[model samples]
Target chain A: MSEASKSARPDGSNRPAVQLRSAVALLGSFPALAGVDLDVHHNDVALLQGPNGAGKTTLLRLCAGLIGPSSGTAMVLGQDVGSANGRRRVRRSVGLMGHSTALYDDLTVEQNVQFWAAASKAESETVVPALDRTGLAGRLQTVKVSALSAGQRRRTALAVLLCRRPSLWLLDEPHAGLDKDGRELVNGLVLEAKDAGATILIASHDLDWATSVATRRIDVVGGRVVEGTVVEDAVVKGTVVKDADA
Target chain B: MLSDARLIAAKDLRIEASSRVLLTQVLPFGLMVLLLFGFGISPDRQVLGEVPRRSVLEQVSPGLFWITVLFAALLGLGRSFSIEAADGNLDGLRLGGLDPAGIFLGKAAAVIVQLAVLEVIVGVGAILLFGVSLANVGLLAVTIVGATVAIGCAGTLYATLAAGQRVRETLVPLLVLPVLAPVLLGATQATEAALFGPVSDGWPWAGLLGAFALLYIAIGIVAFGSFLEES
Candidate 1:
């Protein structure tokens, strides 16, 4: 972790990593997040499970500071994500892996990872280790991303996230398009990140695999967080309440 | 911010180097436009009111050159944002924590570099095909720099606005062309003054170009983040 992120924590260390109260977000006229009240504590591996268009991705995006809430409050990493300036301030400390891998087709796997790491102001030395950890070392690192398979692209994105070493990770369908080994790698990485004191929010449909690593499961239905369950052997305890509107 | 801008610019340039889309496609398209203009305008015909018996093509070369550049720049701008739009790379940049102003400047810088190269190639093509001689190289150089910056800033801003649209390829030119009229006029008039004589006449137009560039750059830096989010 960087000194800047370490210093970004609020005066008290007891603050929740992600706190949303009646938060709502819109995509055009449609409300993707009608009203969501969720709290995820530090070092928690929380899984968000939902059907398509149930606002799982929207909730993740809001936490990542990619989308500001239309109403109510969203605090992530001690920063208010409802305001533009707040979103900008919190963005560096958070990492997101969305539906797209976000890799440049023309750039080599190494170049893509390096560009993102530099953008995040990460240490240059982390780049190679990230590549090796994601199994994109040597000749694969030099190959253009356009030539890579879907699984390779996901691995490259994972390498990018690893290099940043962000405090908060928002992953949407992280296991998609990955082989069995890749899936295990992702689960291992999530566990490693949790052990390293990073908070994670994963939105995935692969429940069997996701549940294995998740400490808590939150169901998102109709743009609201509906039900919560504590996974077996959970470390951190938190509450997930349904929104007032739901 | 400057360091981030440099990183983005270098990344973009590296992508261009690997893709070679500008070299293989857009550059040839620009040269082709100049060639078409050359064929369209009659070489033997003299301007009715000119003193030195200049041909119609030479008299109109400056305007034709700027027009070609404007058309070609649309393609460049489209390519710039299209790359970002593809696979949600723009979102990646935003989430990466790079300052929005830095992204704007970096993208504008990349566009300027590419446009500068296109301008040089098309400028030489215009000179050779239209039989125009350079008289005031300094004024022409200043005009090119200012005009290119103006185009780069405005083009990058508008391109961001149109990015991620289903009709982005068709929408960009519609949004950008009308905004670039002043650049076309300023650059053409300045070039005419540079090529035809009376070098003092071009400085004011060049100043206009510089002002336009500065205004658009400031606006782009302030507004690019919002536009990026919306797109």
Candidate 2:
């Protein structure tokens, strides 16, 4: 295993990597995440499907420790997500790909990845192959991100995430600007990360593509999870109601 | 934390090296300010001719030098944060295992480097254009270093405080300049003593600049996380 994987919880606790109990997050006057209760275990490929302004991005940001819950509990890697110190502890192990590419426009593709790798404390040796995996090998040393198309930018973002080798991937709209080949690449990357013992929570409007590889489907609307809509794999058509007391 | 700061600082410096925006835009802006001051004060030629032109320019160079630093430093600090906003790299940094204080230091250090360059160019422009002779080179150096740190640290803090906002460009200066008045006063007065009076006379003001620098650096390190996560 790569050195980046060493950030996984070393104690090997049986607890789910992510657990939210009535998690509420607010942006200004509106509640982005009204009250979300979710549990995603290690290696679980959970797909979050929601419409616009449905709190999908907020949930992912909360899980990534980029935002804190306004109320109730949200935990990642067994650390409280609402506290500053707790957020810092989980950040090293979690990789988030959001609506923005999170890249330096002035830096070349290679420098962008290497900078992130250094910041993520990943092995420098892993940078080039990560670029190759994302189909950015040719553009690696030559292209500035400002000169790339949106799809190419997305691929470069993926390459940076790949370098981190994070155990938990919180991806918001991971395939938004990608082409057919790029979409396939994202699916492959998700599966690859899962196979490597990573837990993935992806938010996407592309339900068909998202569910294709999802271990479970979580439907979110109006900033709340629809009751009994968390479906497991095997094309199950039933909704298992969660405990009211939970 | 230190390693993370170094990584971020290096990345910013590389970006500046590639774009040359600081050199091509901000540095020229500093020099323009120096020239404008010369023109603005040219009206005083009759009263100033009584003393040597150098002596007259020396009296006012301190204020003009600091004013140039203040405005030019703002351009660099705003650009520093805007680069992070480019790819949500700021959020990326937060999630990449770097603490907020590390980001603060890295960015401030980069700004300090840029401002130090600006200081040098502006300093030379002041000496030649304003006809001011250096009195205490050592004190001037110390004052510039201290004033640069204070501005860099405080400017970075305010830049991030206004990050991701639409009116950030307008807001950053309003938020930073008012807060930096003490720095401006201290730097101006310290530079005056370094230029005209004995170097020892400026030491207390230099101490004030040093204290301000330390205070802002501490505030940045303590508050960067909270301010950064706001977006």
Best by lDDT: 1
lDDT tens string, model 1, A1-246? 222222223345767889999999999899999889988878778899999999999999899898999999999988999888899888899989999999999999999999999998999999998998888998999999999999999999999999999899888999999988788788878877876788889999998778777887899999999987767564322222212111
* TM (chain A) per model: 0.90, 0.88
Residue lDDT tens for model 2, A1-246: 122222344466667788899999998779999999887777777888878999999999899988889998999988898898898888988999999989888999899989989888899999988877887887355799889999998888888888999989988888788887777788878877876788899899877667766777788888888752434442233122222121
Residue pairs that clash (backbone atoms under 3 angstroms), model 1: none
Tell me, by TM-score, which candidate is best. Answer: 1
Q: Which parts of model 1 have CA positions greater than 4 angstroms off?
A: A1-12, A234-246
lDDT to native, each model: 0.89, 0.84
lDDT of 1: 0.89
Candidate 1, residue A127: Cα displacement in angstroms equals 0.3
lDDT of 2 by residue, B1-231 (tens): 787788889999999999999989999989998898888786345434544344445577899899999999889988998898776877887888777899899999999999998898898888888877778888888899899999999999999978878788898899999999999999999998888776777999999999999999999999988888774
TM-score, cand. 2 vs. native:
0.91
